[model samples]
Target: MSEMRLYDAAGNRLYLNAEERAAFLAAARRQSARDRTLCETLHYTGCRASELLEITPARVDLSGGTVTLRSLKKRKDAKGSPRIVYRAVPVPPEYLDTLNTAHGLREAAKSRKKANAPIWPIGRVRLWQIVKRIMIEAGIPDAPHRSPKGLRHGFGINATVNGIPLHMVQKWMGHAQLSTTAIYADAVGREEQDIAARMWG
Candidate 1:
């Protein structure tokens, strides 16, 4: 891969700001239970849309307060066999509660058949549309950073701004290289300013 950038060639931002992120979550709440949890999962975990869709009931560890996501971007191992890399990202306990109430997660996980199946089970095209609709509902203007990728990038930046260690963000984002996670530290905006403010205080 060349590199991961938070901007396109035209210099439009490829990540949502703090306010936009909050708006997206607010709009996500207006969606149906399944869709709301889907959107919230993307927001909280910083996982790719495909990774979010790939999550199964068994992977949601309520007791552990984490969600195990298969890192789709990391495709192969050194020997060229398919590498199924799993990362357990910690999520808010409240999100877990909502997920359980909405999907009966604890119940589904008890059965082997239901545990292995994907939670969302929707195609990429449909999921994309749902995300786009939520963006509009959030009143986020048209921009390069208006899709699920934006949400993932936003999570990275948000975590960095909130003083979460860089290494932790790297693991949460499933970045193979720590350098890739460093990109979020380069993000500038009000959030960064707030971090700087603490120093001046």
Candidate 2:
């Protein structure tokens, strides 16, 4: 059965630790620009793969230093129509520079028609392959968490560990409930230790 824990039902850790995340980023940077942006965007934003795929040039706000993503989970109203929700998450300036350089986002963003095009044109399965390949290249151990979802989980934990508010994490993650986002606050052992160390210091 599924649980509200970071680990899977089989007890596999579902999020990458700091060292693993850093390794994954190093490996990602060695790849081509397209793959690098895809990997880095996922790393920084912690958005789901499908949500990443939906992003167009217009979605990237270079000046504002944020990427707006369309949330995949459609909440229906009383009329049963799916509501489209969007969330904007901040990214680094260098990440924005690389994304603009790789995809010509600035020029594309100028036109409504051009801006609507997806940044990464590949499908979900192909996207999964790219991330998994990067994970292997990073030398992350073989486990249930060695996929894109792991990266997402890592973002949550990293934010929590670094002292971001849970409500803000929930907003950035586009979670429907604060309870869902609260799980990251229950980080284990080493992560807890890091937070404790800061307190003790």
Candidate 3:
């Protein structure tokens, strides 16, 4: 028997590397601004699909540079009761602008109709379709976990490679356990090489 490999050299999951992520973002940019923002939000925030759908203008704190995500994963409290967890993830300045533009702040400033409106009004099915189309356009072919979750996993790998603290990543990603976020530590990157080199030096 041979050892089975689930993912590529990247890690356990099939996540987008930096180049693939860039390509995806570029392809998204070529689409409508709405699509661009939708893709960017998913990648930048590392949020789940359903959590992305819950984003409303009110939930967006532009001044704070954060997006509050409601984690859909059910967890138990001290009493063993189910509870929903919410987390505020920091948004890159450029991504924040993209979202603001997509939401039509100018119009909302006047009519206020779009103020409380959901950023992406489409349902989960439509959102998935849009993401799949973008993935194909970006030259990311079909594969297992090739949907939005891939993007989310990619964000985790990217963050880990960039030297962000694991606990912070856990908090930002709304993981119920730090262990879930720690798995990104296995992602192959310069961080691994640097740590290995220090031992020899």
Candidate 4:
């Protein structure tokens, strides 16, 4: 049997450029409201699709403008006991607005769902389908080398490039290992070098 990877194995390993990010968001906006919300949630939170689906209204602390992530990784104690990982991620202002709008729309639709209802009702299969469609609309090739995972990687790379702290990035990504977060540090260094070259030249 092949060894399993912690992260999903799909999409280009490269981070998205500015133009590509714009195209992705534009294409997402043209999609159904549900899809748009999903895209916004993913871009804002940098959480896995499964984690995004698990988000509830209550998980968002509007006053503090943060969203708490209940990490999906399973842990065991020395004696082999089960435990849960959890992290609190900041909510971008725009994302909070999108969530507010989505919540209002849901309420207006007269859905009596509980406040703790899943933010995204779509199943994982449907989520993948939606991602595929959006990628096509955004002019991405229909290949495993450029899928939704690329978007997630893009988010992390972008954050690091913009000088967000590595530890914070790890927390936002819910990564247990600092080494995992270090991968994007190289990208940030490259970005810095490019900026320096432009200034000198």
Candidate 5:
């Protein structure tokens, strides 16, 4: 017998079609305060769910509307020496309000417990549960390979479709290689083709 691939053999590896994206956002907007913040953070910053859960108040610069993602990827130098690399990603201006709310909630939780802490009080598992619950509530099917990664993919696709340069997307996504960014550019090529068809028609 052959081993099964991690992804479904006959389905899309990613979730969030255009309609589903809209439904997801709308459903997220209807969620409770904390869940709403989590959804907004995931959608706006395109950070991994683990990264979002690791966020600290210090990592978010509300004045600049940016969030720094700590090094999740291992770095290898010319000699194959391993190091850590952090990436700074800009968040949408709208996330400022959501961040402020999340900060306030975290501070309040800390105060109630007499402990100072990070903005997200939950662990990675809890974050996953939160995202899963939100997706299910939004009527999205829970595919094996689909999770908050879909949100990141949606952000990249939308950004590329909107004409953000591949280099910039790479920087925002914290991708070390330009090739990774080009994949997103290629994903948006269909949109470009549709636009061209409209122009010629």
Candidate 6:
């Protein structure tokens, strides 16, 4: 009958700007400490929603300032065997603090116990609902692709624009290929204007 439009029709600009990011985080924070940490984890680590849900308190290493994320994306080695990749993403101590507060556990306790305890303790559908609610509260207009995936893309593009090394971004993002991470380099933002000004001056 008719072609269905299941995705965004306006444009392919999936990355959120700094202001939008901040607004979304602010909205998330108002929801709960758990949500704030969840959104912060997504923003900082660029992990997929599934990976975020897979996070356990034991996976968080506060001393090392990193969280170990198990990649959910399907990957294959040269031998064509499936590979389960894990990445450790550096995060600020404040993000860990929120996590502790949400779970009501200290860092030491988190490390010594709760190996199987999920941090967010929510399913995929619930996580999506939380993200969509936060986006709405932040006044972000509804769109076909305006969801948690957009947050992940925004984190990647934001990192590239801020001059973070592409390889490092790829690792933090749990991307299988550097070429996939390189797409962030094509995102134009304030970084473009600043570079242009330096050249023009």
Best by lDDT: 2
Residue 163 of model 5: what lDDT?
Answer: 80
TM-score of every candidate: 0.92, 0.92, 0.82, 0.79, 0.78, 0.84
User: Candidate 6, residue 115: CA error in Å?
Assistant: 2.1
- Give a tens-digit lDDT track for model 1, residues 90-182: 999999999999999889988999999899999988898999999999999999999999999999999998889999999999998899999
Q: For residues 1-201, could you state the per-residue lDDT of candidate 6 as single tens digits?
A: 233221246654566766678788888778777787888888878888999998887788877889999998788899999998999999888877777777765544535556657878889999998898889999887764468988887788778878899999999998777877877776645447755787799
Ranking by lDDT: 2, 1, 3, 6, 4, 5
In model 6, which runs have C-alpha deviations exceeding 4 angstroms? 1-10, 105-113, 189-201
Residue lDDT tens for model 4, 108-153:
3344455577778778888888877887888876544255666777
Q: Write the per-residue lDDT of candidate 5 for residues 63-166, one digit (tens) a residue.
A: 77787776576678899999766677887767677767755633553453422345667888888788888788888876753478788877777778788888
- Predicted structure 1: clash tally: 0
Give the clashing pairs for model 4: 12-145
lDDT of 1 at 16: 90
How far residue 2's Cα lies from its native spot in candidate 1, in Å, is: 2.8
Report the candidate with higher TM-score, 3 versus 4: 3
Positional deviation of residue 32's Cα in model 2 after best superposition, in angstroms: 0.3
lDDT (Cα) of model 4 = 0.72
Residue pairs in candidate 1 whose N, alpha carbon or C atoms collide under 3 angstroms? none
Per-model CA lDDT versus the true structure = 0.91, 0.92, 0.80, 0.72, 0.71, 0.79
Q: CA lDDT of 193 in candidate 6? A: 74
Selected candidate, larger TM-score, 2 vs 5: 2
Worst 10 residues of 5 by lDDT: 1-10
Q: Which ten residues in a row have the lowest lDDT in candidate 6?
A: 1-10
Segments in model 1 whose C-alpha atoms lie over 4 Å from true places = 75-81, 188-191, 194-201
User: Candidate 3: which stretches are off by over 4 Å?
Assistant: 1-13, 105-115, 189-201
lDDT of 2 by residue, 97-195 (tens): 999999999999789988999999999999999999999999999998899999999999999888899999999999988998988988746577865
